[model samples]
Target: MSSSCPTNPSSSTTRPHTYNRKQKSLGLLCTKLGVERRRIYDIVNVLESIGVLARKAKNQYTWKGYAAIPGALHELKEEALREKLEGSQGVNAKVWDDEDDDETLSNSGSQNDKSIPNSDAPKSHKNDNRREKSLALLTQNFVKLFICSNMELISLDDAAKLLLGDAHSSSIMRTKVRRLYDIANVLSSMNLIEKTHTADTRKPAFRWLGLNENQSSNVINSRKRAFGTDISNIDFKRNKVGVFVNGEFSQKPMKQKELEHVSGLGQVDKSNLKHCTKQSSRSYQFGPFAPASVHKVGPSENNSVKQVHDWDSLATVHRPHYQNEALKELFSHYMEAWKSWYSEVAEKKPLHIL
Candidate 1:
């Protein structure tokens, strides 16, 4: 006898709803489920997309309950079918037009030239609109995988492979997963899907709350309870160790008295220190640990004596010596001879050469 059970049993069957009607945070859910913050976001997006959870604010969500799921599924199915029909028609028309254009271009050279400019013009315009792959479009496609597939959940690795092809290197797949993480975060904020371990292998996977009946239990009944705590009011900086006091953690600003106490503990007497008169000397101080002086100087008295002696020797050497009248007349005659030679050469040169 052969068993008629589904190949992949619903994990949600074993995992019962533990959350109540109270508004819960994605962080709290992550902690409770022992899952990463990023995984929690993926789960939340799938849940929110199906009306299982409603977003109230940033990082906050309100339980909308599972009662709305049937209606949500019906709407999704209708939309999906409509899109499928429109896509098929659009694809067929596009193919026909492309084939007709190809035939016309191949048959007539003149028509090809005219069509070339028009085709090239659209391509240029398309190039202008081309942009880097958008995270939003990636997210929509990611969610569509769940919406279109029969699988209730999908692993990030599998999703990455599906979105980015198996031919991509490990680095490329890692990059795609990172981008998916960001998209998952936005979807989580919207409360569509949720992260959970698979039933068979206990590996992480994102369960689609929009379509699966077992996943419907993940939704909590809405209760008119007090408003959820404002996360902005929570002081994360106050407790580095994350110690909770009473019900919440708080960080109070330093009081004036505390500031005064701290300031007084390290107080010093500024007046007791000697003020530096020179800017260059300010960087160093005349202290016990001061380095030995590198410069050597002679005694002032010795310096003065050496200076006097040097000056006297220079004066003696430079003193004027009396010359005989005949020697002076010989020097003057040689100087006149040089001046006459220089004037002759200068005057004989051409005006252009000069």
Candidate 2:
């Protein structure tokens, strides 16, 4: 006996519509169902798979009986339901419930059959798929959290504990770890998250460098390919009085006087930061390249020409004030870049699992 029952459309012609039918748009469907728009679309796809509703030329789904067309399970609803009893009595309500489903199936055959896919599958399979999708969402949220926090170096254990709901549940913890690694691998492959050894013995670490830098050294350090290294070992040496010029500043060198004016470096170290030297009165001489450029002129003119040191090539001025300026600039760049990098990363889809 088929589980489908035909709706007698002609007989119901005079009957008034019963259920409150409110037209629902896609956005409203998502909100009401508590599912993402994409998930709603997927559900629609699955419904189409079983043929519960017909899709019109405009690609919209109409209610099951709107077309009055018989589908695969049309005869199921007409099947007679049987009463069955077990040990304690002549008839059991529980047992009747099971038989009633069969009765319903037979009576509303096509409609029930079309809707059957949602209930016919094993519970475990459904749960497994649901958990998988949930894990993906968790990972995405974690990544977003990390970026928003602007944390440069973060541990996997911390990330896992923060994301996995039951901190004590080993199974949940393990699942989160696996998902994190999966996401990490995907980001690494895309060159978004760089994986490198931070230390000689420790495991590799991931770095987010989608940010700008100040002394340029900050940017270089951010790009440091070696991960898991001791933060103490990276020789963060400053060769000169680093300037934290704005990104809009020209790349060209500033004269000694100009450097003092902009950097507010006192006259004591001004000579060391010269941009160029004057030879005799007409030509400019650049030192650091003194020996090479001095050869381009006669002995007299070469001797007369003075080195005009530029800001870039200024002699090492590790004055406490300048060092402080450089450090402040470096720190600012680090924080800004980190925040920007993290935000950009979080906005993307989770890499680890689909």
Candidate 3:
């Protein structure tokens, strides 16, 4: 991402599959990965791009797992070399620009710069018309920039320029960088790449970490997550929430992303959402049959009774003081729930709290 970045060389760690390969449906993956179906495409594109997943049918993909990445990177490096070779021979081919956005960075990784050729950028001008801006293609090409060269770090701006080929329109470059940010986020989560800064200018850049096979267990584990990460979002409405993990559909994706920030109380914990009174309310009108226990009051009288039960004032008065933040938030929510219920019930019947 332009705001932060990715980093460092990790030798293609050769390892075994983390788990048994199980074919998963889109809905099932949505449930497992803690993301909506629409957002699933980003994961699909990144995994399919890197050879970790293969589409067996519509809305389903076979999990190739990490075993496929080495082969995929090898193929990409070989393909880039082939393209570079063809370009040298005056044959037209798609090329990755490999040029740095800053000269200081250009000088730092000079050897890597020489290993890749930007001379072919001009020649690949024709491909823009024929080429579609596929995330998978951009992903492969972006990976090619790292795998094909020994460049220690490259910024998203630089990466976008390289992948953009001859299309340097401001709009196109902006779109390319935005997509690159999403790819970087997912890849970083997988540990395939890391975010860092350039050594020279200290500009934000990415270093390819590749596959880390050196862990005690070299397989992908889905159960673990970083602390303080919340994926649940309260704003976006999901159509069909099919299945859930830990008794709820996770608010955020399995992989935490900086782009999707699900911060604050209500976003992660929606259980107390019933306490939110955002809807407009007309004054309650009591019918003649309104229970003998409940006195029939006019709209104005009801309004006066409702005003008497000020939720915030009442809640604040009863709210407990706590030194611990967590306990404080818990009590705060409890007060809010009590307040909402008290206000709603005060309209129909008086409550006597012991």
Worst lDDT run of 10 residues, candidate 3, spans 274-283
TM-score of 3: 0.44
Give the better candidate number (1 or 2) by TM-score.
Answer: 1
* C-alpha TM-score for every candidate: 0.30, 0.25, 0.44
State each model's C-alpha RMSD to the native: 43.1, 32.7, 26.5
Tens-digit lDDT string for candidate 1 (1-354): 012222222232222333211113333333433334553444444444443343334433333323333333333343434444444343221211111222111111112111222453445433222211334234544664565545556667666665543255788778778777665533432234555546555556665543222333321222211011111123222111111111122232311122222111221111111110000000011111100110101111121111111111111111112122211122122212222222222321111100
Local error of candidate 2 at residue 276 (angstroms): 52
User: Model 1: runs farther than 4 Å from truth?
Assistant: 1-132, 211-354
Question: CA lDDT of 249 in candidate 3?
Answer: 25
Question: What TM-score should be assigned to candidate 2?
Answer: 0.25
Best by lDDT: 3
Q: Candidate 3 on 161-227: residue-level lDDT in tens?
A: 6555444678878888988887876665445665666554555667665643232121122222211
- Rank list by lDDT: 3, 1, 2
Q: Quick one: ranking by TM-score, best first? A: 3, 1, 2
